[model samples]
Target: MGTRLRLTAVATAVSAVVLVAASVLVLALFQRQVTDNADDLATSRAEDLAALAAAGRLPDLLTDIGDDSVGQVIGPDGSVLAASASLGAAPAVTDRLGSEDPVRIDLDGVPDDDETEDYRAWLVTAQGPDGPVTAVVGTSREAIREDVLALGLALLVAMPLVLLAAAALLWFLLGRTLRPVEDAHLRQRTFVADAAHELQSPLASYRTQLEVAQRQDDPAGWRAVVSDLLAETDRMERLVRDLLFLARQDSSASAMSLVDLDDVVLEEVARVRPTTAVDVDVTGVSAAPVRGNRDDLARLVRNLLANAVRHASARVQVACRQDATGSLLVVEDDGPGVDPGLRDAVFERFRRGDPARGHAAGTGLGLSIVRAVADRHGGTVRVADGGGGARFEVRLPRV
Candidate 1:
């Protein structure tokens, strides 16, 4: 079943149980009140009959005894001396009756029919003019049963309507609550598809190069093909590492510590200098501290430096410092700066405003990684204007 239907079923079952419990409680309370009333009436009737008989006078005990009420005066020998007209010549319901406590009795075959009756009755023994006699009074339980059945029927009619309304309201609210998650899932699917398509380019190149190398008979041609193949493999490895780092940062946001921005910048610049001839200048450094994962922040700096080194005409400058707002890092190169309109677009995955930097220059994920790292650290990166070339500025909250 769908979520809505499943939730509705669960809610309906719970509401049904609650309704049933409430109905049973109400029924019990009503039954108790009716029983108490019946017992009091029966006991009062039995006491009045005993008092009249003991006074040696037969008053109006015969008055209004037809209200489903039965009373009888038993002689000292368990023989009936006086009784309501409805119970003519009937013996005591119980054989051993002495106290005036109320008792429940089931009257079956009272009128010689295939039916049974229920009653609450009280019995007492009192001194009479003739001798000790037993006084008994009782009333039928038909009225209590009728009220209880009526209540049950009313609940049976109303419960379904209440449950349906509640289910409908919950379905609407839950749909509204999960909409953002649904949108994110769709976006993730699209991202995966885009990533797969991007990855296919390098793999197809490797296959074509290898297939050609197998057919080429010249040793120099095979060697050249092998070198180009290794370059493509390096590109794929970098792409994989970038994807993994982004995924890890996405999954682990709380694993962050205080990071020194100046150290991160100087370290990346030094690493790049040993591998390339680009003149990387480091100038801005004055207590640029922030909170972030050390490895991820290092990766971010490396990407920025790599991007600069790949595209810089001659020199790349790395700057880091803390300001009143936050920590700032800027990587500027003297190559052709990006188009003003394409600055934001370059930070998207697989986006390369300077694809001329070649396959070996870097994966197009450099700026995207920079942006992702900044975002993970509760910071932001944007392409800001430089003096001559592109300047990528990063700002992160200070520790």
Candidate 2:
């Protein structure tokens, strides 16, 4: 949030600077055009008057420019030849240019305190009969100043409104985009609480059964009951372990490492053979290295083997080989192959195929765990036809 606020501030500052620059450009263009128009008008009038003075037609030309604008002509000695009353009584061009260079000056010709005030002037020059004549054309400075002030005020008002609108848009878009993250967090929290509650019941039942068996007088029956309870406890433990492994896979903090594919498969097959008919057959096994958590990869292999053993009639076959692309680990069972339509569904959590066929004892999380581990390693698992049995294949990239 702090970073976003800072970004918003930076955006506003950049917008303000850009708007101010545009307004400055507009104001400069307006001023240049206005001043150019004024200069052209004054120069044209001065030329007309200079021609009149040369032809001795001052009265006629002066009448022609009666009430248009203030005008004045000055000689080499800075003396005014003819001046207009549109310019109120004030210092002549000669007086205003008292020691300064004879340049244009924008100022009032009359005291602003007086009513019916005339505020105008134009300093100019022309070719007189004896020498070059100087003329001063005058106009009101108040109107020009007001126009500039109004331009500045408009820019100042409009810039903030634009920035405010932009900031509001940015805030709304950020909120909407991040809403999914909030929902994901809420879902995870709910899953954790539910998992804890689900785990408590089985654990409590196992503990009660064990305590009752321990206090019984006849030891043989109690021993068998205690053994079954221990088995149930171990099943719960395995489920919890599988759940923890999946939770870690979901977390963003986890990482993978390069592992030997052949070694992982052999090790897991050896680990599960102590309790089942686990057979590993690697005719052309590739010693390819892949990126994955060694422990999760081993667990994935174990789960696939365990699932096969639990349902196999006679044996489980494990094969590791490579193709043109990457390494492949195939676990085949001589039991009934999964139905063609149900292959994809078998990988889902708690999914059992044709429960009427056989009651296979499993927590139903094994294949799901296998899929998650394979996915984290940038690999995939699929079930395909294996002649007369089920074939589970895990394919991973060679690193």
Best by lDDT: 1
Runs of candidate 1 exceeding 4 Å displacement: 1-103, 106-143, 146-196, 253-255, 273-281, 308-317, 323-326, 332-347, 353-361, 382-393
- Residue-wise C-alpha lDDT for candidate 1, range 1-399, written one tens digit per residue: 265567767877887788778878987898788778777877787788777767756433355443766777777777776876555676846475555454445544344134545555677677876677677777776766776788778877887887778778777776787666665565567557756977899889988888888887677898899889888888788888877665655555557788887887777777889998889888665569899888888888998888888888899988888888889999899988878888899898778775444344556778888898899888999989998788999999867
lDDT of each: 0.76, 0.70
Query: What's the lDDT for candidate 1?
Result: 0.76
RMSD over all Cα atoms, model 2: 7.7
User: C-alpha displacement of 8 in model 1, angstroms?
Assistant: 7.4
Q: Write the per-residue lDDT of candidate 2 for residues 1-399, one digit (tens) a residue.
A: 654566667777887788789889998998777666665666566567666665555641133443435666565565555666544333355554322223556544444435443434455445556766655665555555666788778878887898799888776775576556655575488458646765787778877777777677567778787778778878788777777777767665545778888898877777777876545455545576777778888889888888888877777788887677788889888777888888888887667664532668777778988898888878899998895778999998877
